[model samples]
Target: MLIVSGWIAVDPEAREGYLAGCRRVVEEARATPGCLDFVLSADPLEADRITVYERWASDAELAGFRGSGPEPEQTAEIRDAQVHKYRISAIEPP
Candidate 1:
């Protein structure tokens, strides 16, 4: 499985809009073929911080979703928002 985590810092004034856009993206991504799980969370102590947790079947599938499709625009909007740190890793369950 492919797991990705990202930390996002949003503009204080644009938080609401950013979150609304993120919600739409998450919903659409969750419906995609290779998406096993998708989640967005806010940091309790940080008003402008947001985190994304995602699981996909493979890197190719995730790349395909990133390129073209109905959710691309919304995803791009979220990406264009603010600076973020992200990581992707392979996981094995015991």
Candidate 2:
């Protein structure tokens, strides 16, 4: 599996717009094939900061999503976003 973690900084005045865009992206992403999970969260300490967590079946699946440009509006709303993708061996037991 592939796991992705990221942070996005948004303008304070554009926070609502950013979140609306994010919701659209998340909905579309969740419907994509091989999308195991997709989540977005706001930083408790920083209202303008957003965090992302996602799991995909494989790197190829992720690449396919990226190639398809599924979330153009949301992608554009983010100020400075940094993402890290990792190959996951397992998920921690709950």
Per-residue lDDT of model 1, residues 1-94, tens digit only:
6777776666555656767767877887899899988877776777767777788888887887767643554344443334332444544576
Any residue pairs clashing in model 2, and if so which?
A: none
Against the correct fold, how does model 2 do in TM-score? 0.81
Number of clashing pairs per prediction, in order: 0, 0
Model 2 lDDT per residue over 1-94, tens place: 9989988888877876777767877887799899999988877888788888999998888888768653676667777888899898877879
89: Cα error in model 2, Å:
1.7
lDDT of 1 at 79: 33
Query: Top TM-score: which candidate number?
Result: 2
Clashing residue pairs in candidate 1 are none
Per-model root-mean-square deviation over C-alphas: 4.4, 2.2
For every model shown, what is its TM-score relative to the native structure?
0.68, 0.81
Off by over 4 Å in 2: 68-76, 92-94
- Model 1 global lDDT (CA atoms, 0 to 1): 0.67
Which numbered prediction scores highest in lDDT against the true structure?
2
Lowest lDDT block of 10, candidate 2: 68-77
